[model samples]
Target: MKAFVIERYGKQEPLHLAEVPEPKLGEQDVLVRIHAASINPLDLKIRSGALKRILPLRLPLVLGNDLAGVVTQVGTKVQRFKPGDEVYARTDTRRIGTFAEFIAVAESNVALKPPSLSMAEAASIPLVGLTAWQALVEKGNLRKGQKVFIHAGSGGVGTLAIQLAKHLGASVATTTSSANVALVKSLGADIVIDYKKDDFAKTLRDYDLVLHSLGSEELEKSVGILKPGGQLITISGPADPEFAKNNGMPKLVQMIVGLLSRKIRKKAGKQGVGYSFLFMRGSGEQLSTLGELIHSGAIRPTVDRVFPFEETNEALAYVEGGRTRGKAVIQVVALANQA
Candidate 1:
């Protein structure tokens, strides 16, 4: 199968097209003929060796995470999906390599694609969609009539997060550059702060939740905006000790995490607020629910660009710039006159 792989993590020059052996499917996995794949910030971090200590990878690793495709074969133990079923997923990080003609993912990680969207659009939803869903619904416990703020409103996750918050009956506020203010507003953000010119911490107050995705400075400012007892769920740095415990790290690592987390936890305690880190996980059931939302016209996929399969390097370059309006997809298979 033809795929793009990275022999060493560094610049984009290491990315090259090659014919690699097809992956062997596990007993609980399904082989998918990939139609489209999307690039996420995680992909760029992996390509740059920024996550080397955390997510160790073998050399010549294939690069991609989100995929939308058709099932070609199903594992013996897989009952939810079958041959010819259209599916989409944020595949297991350990088995990631969606930059190929085919990939084998566990049945538990994939769900039926939304019927209302094309393969290209569906490819954009899995990773970011799941992140937004888990952050707002599962961890944050956002309730209707609440007020929530999402950072980077024009980015992949923020675009979806805004809509999800609105769908759940929350009044959403978000931060973006001036150019994207209208876009985020259209996506249902009731308030849009121009991050380049305004301070979000000063602009918003008494928020029930803050979905953070920025630097430490922004994270520090986020606390001031939340009302007492409100929550801040961050996806960037500031790893919580609970996250370290959940991942089963060594005691020393846990202690280090505790030390790192103590400052934020203490600060939150002083304000009667809560703080935690969120690293998204795959859940087919949640994805199926999200698919229903998409299928029902309650939510829509937002794509900023589509690159050909062979231009994976260029796509990576574009995302690294960190100014995309939404998701960026790679069209792996040529559609019949769809272009």
Candidate 2:
């Protein structure tokens, strides 16, 4: 299989195209012939070694997380999928290597691709879609008619989060710059705050939930805007003890997070609100549910750009710059054209 791999962590210059041996499938895994793969901020962080402590990596690592592909083979225990089945998934972070001609993903982390989308579109949906779904629906338990705020409404996760929140019947508010206000609004954000000009914390108030993607400073201020006992979920850092326990994090990581939470927790406490951090895990069941939503037009994939397989570096550069309005995808194989 052909793959783009990094021979070393830290330097972007080390990323190079190379031929590698295909992954040996485990009893619980399936081999996927990759059609498209999406770039994510998490990939950049991993490539730069920013997550070394939390997610250790070996050298010459292939870097990608979300993919849409066709099943070429399935392990003995994989009864849900078979050869020729089209699937999409947010692959496990520990084994992610989707920037390739193929991937071997655990069956538990694979889902049937939404029938309504192309491979590139399907590839863009998984990671960010799962993140939004887990944050708002699973963890936050956002209710219909309730107000929910999503930060970075024009970004990958924000775009999907806005649509999902609306589909669930929640009145959604989102933050974006002035240029993207119209885009977010069109996607179903009832209110759009221009983060560059206006302070969202001061302008928006009495929200039932705040899906925050920014840093700790913005997260702290978000509590003031929440209605009493409302929840504030951040994807950035400082994990909440209660959510950590519920999510079944390792005891050592949980303990370290607990000590850190005292600082942020005290702040949320002062405002009479709940605070938690979100570290999304892959789930095939959740992916299938999201796929159904996509197929039904309840939620749609919003892609800002698509690059050819050879232009993978350029695609990564675009996503790393943080200027993209929505998801960026690399069409790895153009499976439709091959047929």
Off by over 4 Å in 1: 11-13, 337-339
Judged by lDDT against the true structure, how good is candidate 1? 0.90
Q: What do the candidate models score in CA lDDT, each in turn?
A: 0.90, 0.89
Error of 2 at 314 (Å): 1.3
lDDT of 2 by residue, 128-211 (tens): 999999999988998899999998999999999999999989999888988998999889999988988989888898999999
What tens-digit string does per-residue lDDT give for candidate 1 at 1-339? 999988888855458899999989888999999999999998988888876655678988999998999999988898899999999988887788999999999999999998788999999999999999999999999999999999999999999999999999999999999999899999999999998898888889999999999888888888888999899999886788898888777888778778877877788888889999887887789999999888777789999999998888888889889989999999999786333
